[model samples]
Target: MKRLVLVALVALALGGCATTAPYGNFVQPPVTVDQQQLAGDAAKQLAALWPPAKTRFELQQPTPDEFGAALVGNLRSSGYAVLEYAPQKASGAGNATPEQKDADPVVVVTPTTVALPLRYVLDHDAGTGLYRLTLLVGSQSITRPYLEQNRVLIPAGYWVRKE
Candidate 1:
């Protein structure tokens, strides 16, 4: 009887050792938003005729510094006022040159990604995931036909300010 009880205790100990903390507790490393979306013809058409607007801007990305350069380039080409936060000493030059000129609104873009649970395991643990993010400023002001068509539209409430 005592031997049987000892064996049972050993089994319990082994089972306890086999248990592990869930994977959800780990912090996910930040990811970049590589996909680019344009406001399309309406914006391009408007920008072409109208002079670029003067404004202050800042772009924040959860990814690396190079992501900022890409965003700046895209925004400039689309005709938005893009500056490095100082409106007074703004450089009218973008990745493009003077003859072609770029777009306006002095846009600041911040791109980031957040992990979303795919499904809960046993109704309490996240098994897989996805990322959803959006532009906090001027997102509503402009229409993104490509984003809508692709179904990558960031919902209204998911806006997170880029730091």
Candidate 2:
């Protein structure tokens, strides 16, 4: 009986040594996503346009950087080169001309507090089509078309997917 108890203790110790899954591994990362605000027809469409991880995209958080870290972490996991852009305040030009010539798109995350938890402002002017994003309860992200889009009708601005 003592030998059996020892074996059980060893098994328990081994199990404890196992590493726990990262926060992002879980569907809902201990965060809250309000659904009522996210509800509507356009949310699904935005989700579809949201850039996937692994791609090289520039990031500009104009808002209070609500999900900046969390988002970058997620994107990095997917093998994306998430570059942050902080244009020189002294320069009159908002974006450098040379950078604009590149094919890589710039991602803008602007939080619309008036509509947060329901929707976030995503600007990728370099990208092309209609884009939309809505955050639902249980941290669920529902998007239509079931894929990301490269060509959007609206290139830059804080507008939801109307079409």
Candidate 3:
């Protein structure tokens, strides 16, 4: 009985080390308004935190949805060299750019390039009729709330940054 109990405890301890994916499915509901404005707002806030010309990002989520595409465009327009690829596949691939369909093949790392991993989450609160956008970069994050009225989304509050 003592040996059996010890074995069970060891198995449970090993199981505790397992981890799931860090990211969840991006929630983008259909809206009548263009998402570029919202995405541009987010990009502007991000650029304020980390200068786009000095920073490079590897986007962890590669969803081809409207918000994702718009965010990428906004980031690029802000002068950020964003990398869109699967994190798992990029492992052990060195600095070589991975081949992706319909994506620009250019992910070069330089000495001055501040490469940081980035992810975003957009969620809508049905009860309050507000949308929240969260952008995570490395160990830092910024969140902003937006309200949709007259078929347009506008910032509802000041952006909050967390380190």
Best candidate, lDDT? 3
Off by over 4 Å in 3: 1-28, 90-114
Clashing pairs in 3: none
Q: Residues 86-115, candidate 2, lDDT per residue (tens digit)? A: 545684346658756565766788633222
lDDT scores of the candidates, listed in order: 0.36, 0.38, 0.79
Q: Per-residue lDDT for 64-141 in model 1, tens only? A: 233234555655676565544332556646655654464454669653422111110011112423333223343222
Candidate 3 local lDDT, 27-83, one digit each (tens)? 455566667788889888888888878889888877577888888889998999988
Please provide the root mean square deviation of candidate 2 (C-alpha atoms, Å): 18.7
Each candidate structure's count of clashing pairs: 8, 15, 0
TM, every model = 0.27, 0.27, 0.70
Index of the highest-TM-score prediction:
3
Which structure is stronger by lDDT: 2 or 3?
3
Candidate 1 Cα errors over 4 Å, as ranges: 1-56, 60-66, 85-127, 138-163
Better of 1 and 2 by lDDT: 2
